[model samples]
Target chain A: MKILLCTDGSSYTARALDLGVRVARKAASAVDILVVAKRDREEKARQMAEKAAADLETAGIPVAIHRRSGQMTEEVVLQAQAASYDLVIIGGRERRGVMRLLLGSPALRVTEHVPASVLVVKGQARDLKQVLVCSSGGPTSERTVRFAGRLARALGASVILLHVMSQLPLTKSAVLDDLEASAEELIRRGSPEGVHLGRMLDLLATEGRTGHAVIRRGLVRDEILAESREGQYDLIVIGAHITPGLNARLVEDLSAAILLTANRPVLVVR
Target chain B: MRRRQGKRLNWRKPGLALSGFLLFTLALGLMKGGAGGLTPLLRNHLEVTNAADSMGFGWLMAYLVLSGSPVAAAAVALLSASVLSYLQAFTMIAGSRLGACLVVLLIGCIYILRGHEHWTALTAGILSLLLTGSIQLAALPMGLLILGRGWLDGLSIPALEGLAAGINWGLEPLIGPLAAFLPGWALFVAGVGLVTLSFRLFDRALPQMRLERTDLGQIPRLVYRPEVMFLMGLAITLLTMSVSISVGILVPLSARGYMRRENIIPYILGANISTLADTLIAAALLGDPRAVTVVVTHIVCAAIISLLLILLAYRPYERAISNALAWIARRRNNFALFLGVIFVIPVVLILL
Candidate 1:
């Protein structure tokens, strides 16, 4: 497997480099460290890339240094697309209060716009001890579970797969009486949440990564945030998007909320 | 030779039923006014001089009948017949609404007995009570103030003039023969039966929801936006013309895991306000401008209170109700306490 790691010469960027090195060394994957900078800061960007590459090389892992100039998110996105990389790891830029509201951090933007999976490394935890993954059993859940498993296998980490259900479910009258609805048996079933957790556990087992499953009933965002804080897990993984439908829009997107509020690193896998 | 079978709209199925429903409603209205031979006893014993007492009296009356519309009709009849003052009549309507909320909860009790958990079985019914209680309670003071000021009283009933005349003219022929054949008390009993039949007809005309277990199971877990639920509640109540029916629809949905905690309150609020349409008809039938004023006060008060809560304090209100519900659902003893409280409140009010 090949991985693309993006840095902007920031503290979070350094953490991303650490994660990439550790992951690549365990999985025997090649790492390409890319430093995205403006025209004036190209020299600074290249130096950061060279340092990341040297660090990976010392671990006896294959590595390359790439330097680019332009918008940080756009350059990283372009480079990942241009190369055949299995995963893209980036660092979250922390800003306070109004600055965050007006100017979104680069890492959030990359996760929002990227078609491929992007991990926004948040904390400085290096041992890769624990990971928490949240799922709603949407279409993207299988991919999210599979990717989290791969990460666990590479880092020798334990996984916690969580699925949050509403304590009080809401009912809406259907437009057509489903009783009058005519179709095969396949069309009759609903998207049960347990189906997602089961698939995730099965996928993780295939990768030889063992994990415990948590079924929480409450507000999705609140339960996820509370669990992450209480567990103090090293990393949090969630789907970047749900299977888009009118039903999907009813609740606030759990992924977006967790990524913003989670103190630990959040990997918004697509 | 082939025999030809003739058909014309098959009035027996839909049309005859519709006409019978209308006739039943007409009969029920006449029966409502005449049936109150017991009205004098109730008024004197209840001592309902003001809004508070009237609300208490109306609530008890609705509980006795197990229906809001009949109590609302009784309120209007009392107002028209000089049995209750305008203030007493208006407050009685409010009380009837509060009492009407218990009907769904009573149905929920049946579900609970049949082996469903108290949480799923009673959530819809309890939500109906809570939303109705909150909005109606909020509107009580506003309704009193509005009626006291005579601000809305000046609104004309010109549009209803034609409707009032047509209803009386059509029902007058049927009333004479029925009155001569039936005693006064019999008229009220027959009216209650006909009213029940009319509601049954309405229920029959509605397209079947007929949700399978799969759909029923899914809806309980799904949640909708407050505004969406509010509109849905209003629309369904308008179609069914009864809050009990709308709430009963939620029971199966809740049991199957289709209801959300947040979706129910707003929907109940919508259904509560819309359910007053029956009283509106009752007010028109009375043909007293003051009767119209009383009903309007009920509507305006409920609307103001519900709108305010939906816009401003919905989250806190939702949380408070939900937390309480969760507390009850988590324990068997608490559920019994809740049932006792709901059952006894009206009984205590009736006695006092």
Candidate 2:
């Protein structure tokens, strides 16, 4: 796995870089740090990239730093498109007033336009144990679940697969029975036929998927975040309708609700 | 700096040319009306049954269709006023009334810039008209020549006859009472006033209306893919056809309104007359009659209205007529918006 770590020299970015290096070290993947800057200052941008590369190298994580200049969103998107980076990591900052009013922060624009998966590290909340994955009946949800399961397995953590069904006259018996059957089928069909269903199945399989089968009926973003907090998940994995670029800001993506409100790491898969 | 100065100079020349053109067109119109003894000729012409002289109505209809679009219509009117000064003299009376709205728009722009330097505001106003007018002039002749005289001849004759028939059906009952009580000019003035008032109200309100500019700069993230345009186009076509058919059925009922069937002829004729404002303004500046005639005939067609209605109906629900056009042109071409504006705005303005 090749991970792309995006930083802006902010403290939050530094934390994201540290987390990215750790993840890369564990996954045995090479780490590429992309520093996107405005076009007018090339020397400062290059110096920043060199310093970041040196810092990452000291951590024993193989690092390649790329310095890009232009409108941050376009530069990041262009690089992401050219490189076969499996994941993109970026830092999020709380925006307000005129900064928020004009062009939304670069991270938001990148999230809106990029095609690659994004991981937005918020602040100091680094240790990810309990993982939450919002599942729809679609293929994106299935891919998200499988990805979350792999990460959870690596961390020796528990996985929560949340399916928020907004439609209801929720008779508990019928709803529970339907959920059980769908969860069993998802596990059975989502994995290989010959592979043991026992490994994929949750401890509460008779009830539904592992962790919790949350059926809170509301907006998709609100329900996902509510479940994340209530269920005490450290990391939330959501399917994105868009990809993230180097300078892509968080506010642009609706899915960035997880990063903005949840105070947890958001792993967005496209 | 040098390039900027050159551009400024280039801009200034067009501005001067445009002001001169507008003044010339207005002067020519006044002169034609004066030369012909406006009251006698207008009254005589109104009373005469030109049913046998199909050419006169045909010419009117031809001019109407050609002037349906702003660029073409204005040029044609200007050309007619300059070369066929005799015919244009009468045409300008009606054309000027309709074209006066654009003059108002230009004037409004001036007022908007009132706080700025006088010379700068004047320069900007002239520059805007010149740039816009040049584009209209260039586009008009091409549109007319492509459509050709034969096709226009057929369209105008039928459209004029249809309009006349529609009006006669509507006005036959009221004509006697109206003739006895109201003068012709009274009705004309009332109609013109209503149009002008509606336009004023609309202009005042439109600025407050908000429209979203959906950024489709990234192709991969587009919610509605390229295939959606075809689907949307088909849906719009079906809806427009249905509405048109329904309107046709209700024409008799609609005749009861103040805008009787005969009004349809003038309504359509007024659209032709109004559309000529832009082109006429352009031609007056260029002093080109052939180009103006060609443009005017093409724009005045019934097809222009049909096309405009079709486009307006298809404009997306969330979008204004302008934004929907921008979205539709996202992948195809930028010129689509300009073409759409030429077709859509005049019809909307005239019908409203």
Candidate 3:
């Protein structure tokens, strides 16, 4: 897999690079580092990209660095689309006002527009023990859940599947029953084949009463944010695919909303 | 202590009162001008009977509904407007019943403010409905006369007919040689330009005329319950539909007004008005319509829905209805589910 790391030469970018290197090492994927600079600052951007690329290469992670000019967010998105990279990793900036507006936060715009999944890293690295997957029982969500289950297993984390049953005039008893049936199906489908599967099923049957399912009702984004805040999970996995330009804008807008609101680091896996 | 209290009182904010006055003045001016300009245009080309014209009052009611929740307002408005067109085929009295209920509920709301020293304002709303209703009833004779004379041209007709005769009979003979010299295309361009200019001017000059911000801070404390919101949305849509249907059936004579060529304008206007129900319901259920800017958003969305509907006609609404129904199907067991499956399915299957 080709992993794209979007950098702006900030300290956050450096940390995100470190995290990307670690993730690439684990996933056995190649890292493609992309730096977007102002049109006039081509030399500066090239220098930063080169240094980061050399450092990652030295750390035993294969690196391919690319630099371009223009509005940072738009350029990065265009590059990601052009390259067709599997995933885009970017640093979350803490800048405010004009500087922040001009550079355009990569984490904000890329998450929304990019067809590939995005990983927005913030602050220090910690063990990812609990993975929460938001599911709507759609194909996109099923894919997300499967990916999350693998990541949880790798990290020795227990998976918590949450389904936000929006209170849309359904009786409480009916909604609860639907949630239970869905939870059972998810657990059954998510388990691997063979000896591991039997043990997983036994574990689920026992803890399924407590650890497995969570159902909340409200707006989609709000409910997701609320669950994250309450759970304080280390990473959030979301799905994405390359969308048309106009649809990208709509997704871009939604991504910006999530970034501004969500507290935890989001690992968007395609 | 008394002197200090007096000084503190003197320092109390002054700008709020000033701003309020300015906003009220601006709102009044826009309302007057908009009513004046659109009324004449609607009358001339559409030739809706006066009773049907009173349906415009429903527009004001819709504006109230939307003022509270624009997003939901826009959705409801789009659905209601599209449904209204079909409902008109049944009977004008049925349509009038639907239209009148909306108007009455909205106009009736003003009465709630009667005890708050705004009794006169409430009275004005009641009086406006009465006056408008009377005028519309009175205009029936004039509409009949025009129809009898074959002057009532439907939307399917072209704007121009017998240009040479019009120039000779209606222009040159009536207004003399100056009318013939007037560039018709230039005049049309100028008229469009003037309308655009007025709209811009009104938008710029009017302050309070702007959409009221949903007070979101109160959402958490109020009806954040999803069930409540769903019910409220359902109730408002049903009530609006029922009222529109009844008006169409009961006031058979007012059919043309409900189905005028320029019906899109009121339909668009009603889109904003219908949202007020959601906001009001939100306020009642949740006690805060703030977190859910559904109404405000819907109002903004109405412009998009209106443009699309005007351009695409039934196609856009059909897609929206289907999409909404599909969403309901996925979520399953909701009110929309029962309505879509139980109500729509049986009816459609029986018809098929």
Local distance difference test values of all predictions, in order: 0.69, 0.43, 0.42
lDDT of 1 by residue, A172-266 (tens): 22211222222221123332444555567778999889887776554556678888888888888988754356555554355766777777778
Write one digit per residue (lDDT tens) for candidate 2, span B29-73: 223222223234333553312211221322232234322122123
Q: By lDDT, is 1 or 3 better? A: 1
A26-60 in candidate 3: lDDT tens per residue? Answer: 55357787887655555655676677677667767
In order of DockQ, best first, we have 1, 2, 3
Task: Report the error of model 3 at residue A122, Å.
Answer: 3.1
In candidate 3, stretches whose alpha carbon ends up further than 4 angstroms from where it belongs are A36-60, A69-71, A92-105, A123-127, A149-158, A170-211, A241-256, B1-352
TM-score of each: 0.76, 0.36, 0.39
Q: What number of clashing residue pairs does each candidate have, in the order they appear?
A: 10, 34, 57
The digit string of per-residue lDDT tens for model 1 on B1-352 reads 1223233434334764566457554754566556555455555765555556777878876777788877787677667666677887887888888888777667667665766443555655666676777677678778778888888885437666467667777787887777777776567666656665666676666654543343223345444556666776777787677887775566565443344455666777888888877667667755777887888888777877777777787767776766676677667788788777866776665565
What is the C-alpha DockQ of each candidate?
0.22, 0.02, 0.01
Candidate 3 per-residue lDDT over residues B68-168, each given as its tens digit: 12222222222222222211111122112223323433433344344322211222122223322332333334433443443422211112223322322
Which regions of candidate 2 are displaced past 4 Å?
A37-61, A70-72, A97-101, A169-213, A242-261, B1-352
